[model samples]
Target: MRRTREEAEQTKESIFQAGIELLATKGIHETSMSDIARAAGVSRGAIYWHFENKEALLREIRGRLQSFYKSLVDAAHIDSAPLAESISRAVRKLFKKYRNDAAFRRLQDLNIKISVLYAGKDSFADDIIKTEEADIQLFCEAVEGSPATNSCSPLQMFMIMESLVGGLLIRQYIRQELLSDEDIDAAVAFMVKGFSGIEEKTKTIHQEQ
Candidate 1:
């Protein structure tokens, strides 16, 4: 018998959830489609119905995470605020999500695992950075929208900002140091004040010119 659209959607969500849990506990290479099927309480055929292979399934998982991050970016939107403040709010918003949301944290853990553990692999490793493409765009827009746009290329600015976030996350994940409340404040300061100096320097040069 054919499944209802809602049933198909639920099965897909179940497969995603099960895949995330297994990827975290078992690692990507170790987990199989059958394992995901068993964990999701679906048959192997059901798994294949949604994904052609494990790589496709992994990409789908990353897609969901990308959307989640996009939502965070969207929620942090402060149109009336200055670009730096708006972007800072977005970053802080994400940090809060990381601290408070178990699923968000696990998704991050899974992200690090895919990017780091499978760096040499084919599709898995590719998906890691591919998922970040939208965020890079988000940061680009934020930086270009700022008064500091004259100081550097938006891509350069995006890389610098994302690096700060990525470095902190990797270090914290490795060292098992949960971010202190102070760290969140420091993040905002770093993002905001970091560019303040750049903007000032650019203004001086432009005035001199």
Candidate 2:
């Protein structure tokens, strides 16, 4: 029997999700198309029909994550808003997604594992490194473009923000606890205040020099 287009797409999505879960838990080198097929309850032939290879599937997953970050970048670049407000809103939204969105949580888990497992290795390592560097540049540029006073370098601000946000997510991922809204907000506020203080200190140094 010929499968309907909707059915084929549904199967493809199932296979894709299964691949993510296995990759997140087993690491990329340990996962196989057969594993994904078994987890998805589909045949190897079905997996091949939807994806050419594991690398192709990983690229699709990376692309979805990139698109989500791009939207956050856009949100953080609002011209009329204060830089701190814009950044806080974007960060809060991301933390909220981590707490509430199961699929997003899985994607992020897969991404973190991939970077840790592949760094300083081969092609996949280089690709993930370049992608991360580019993402950092995007956030830096957004910060630089903001109207609010920014005495610190954009890269400096971005590094601090990334460290805090990444640490929070990593802890959440490892501990299996969806952090409370109040906890998330308090952490975010602390980061913003720290960033603001750094900017002010930098400005004072510039004035003295």
Candidate 3:
């Protein structure tokens, strides 16, 4: 008997979910189509019918995360707020989602695992790096256009922001304790202020040269 469209989509979603869990917990190299089929309670044939291979399935997962990150960047640019405030708001929103959304958290965990385990050896890793560089460039352009003082270069500002958020996320992942919105705001403020003297320091050094 042939399955209806709805049934096929449902089966695909189940397989996708099971694949995420297994690949995340078991590591991508160790997980197989047969394992995903067993976890999804579907036959290997069904898994193959939906995804051509494990890499195809991983591409779909990566697409979802890319969309999620893109939305955050788009929303941050939707208004004329100061760069620091906009970044702070986006960071707080991200932490809130990580704390409240199980699927989002799982996807993040899976992405980190993939990057760690396959960074130099896989096409997926190259794609991940390209996506991240594109995202950072978007923010760098925003910094250049903003009215804020360029105490540091746009690229430097972006690297600082990325480091701050990435470090906090790793800390939260290990501690399993999300920081409060107020705390995040304070941290962002400090980061913004931390570079306020860079322009003056550079001027002093240039004068001495």
Candidate 4:
């Protein structure tokens, strides 16, 4: 029997949904293509037809997450905003996802955990790394156009900010802490303050020179 294109698309989506649930609950190492097939109620052959491997399925998940994160950054981007403001917006955007986007955040938490476990040896690890770096590059752009640009490198600033976000996310995952509105606000404040301190210190040094 020939399957319609729409049917195929639906099956693919089902497989992805199943894969994400399994990945979140079981972690990548425990979740397999067969597991996804069982959960999706599709045959193993169907899973293979849709995705070449577990990595391929995860790549799709990562792509969706990348698009979601990109939308947030695009919405928050402002030409005239201060770098700290831009960074705050981006961080706040992340916590918004934490509160609202469960699947993406699960993938995000798993990606961080797996990176440490795999240590750059896994091919799929690069997808997560690249996606995160590309997202943080938004803030790097903001730094480039900021008045404090001379104080620090935009790439360095981006790295610092991204690390702070990443660390907090990892902590949340490990501690199983729920990030409330107030918690998110405080986290954003800390991020803004950390970067602002750097900016101000650099400014004072420049003035002294």
TM-score of each: 0.85, 0.78, 0.75, 0.80
Worst 10 residues of 3 by lDDT: 142-151
Tell me, what's the RMSD of every candidate?
A: 2.7, 3.4, 4.3, 3.0
Residue range 114-174, candidate 3, lDDT tens digits: 6566667767777776767777677666556443433566777766766887777777767
Query: On a 0 to 1 TM-score scale, where does candidate 2 land against the true structure?
Result: 0.78
| Tens digits of lDDT, candidate 2, 23-125 | 8778788999999999999998999999989887886777677754565467667879666767788888888988898989999877677657556668876
- Give the range where candidate 4 is weakest over 10 consecutive residues by summed lDDT: 67-76
Residues 71-131 of candidate 4 have per-residue lDDT tens digits of 5356446657656776588678777888687776787776665567667665666666777
Off-target runs (Cα >4 Å) in candidate 2 are 1-11, 24-30, 39-46, 132-135, 145-150, 202-209
Clashes of each: 0, 0, 0, 0
Sorted by TM-score, highest first, which candidate order results?
1, 4, 2, 3
Each model's lDDT comes to 0.76, 0.78, 0.74, 0.75
What range of 10 consecutive residues in model 1 has the weakest lDDT sum?
68-77
Top candidate when judged by TM-score against the true structure: 1
Tell me the tens digit of each residue's lDDT in model 1 across 5-84: 99999999899899989988898999999999999999999999998788887676567667544653563355686656
Judging by lDDT against the true structure, name the best candidate.
Answer: 2
Cα lDDT of model 1 overall? Answer: 0.76
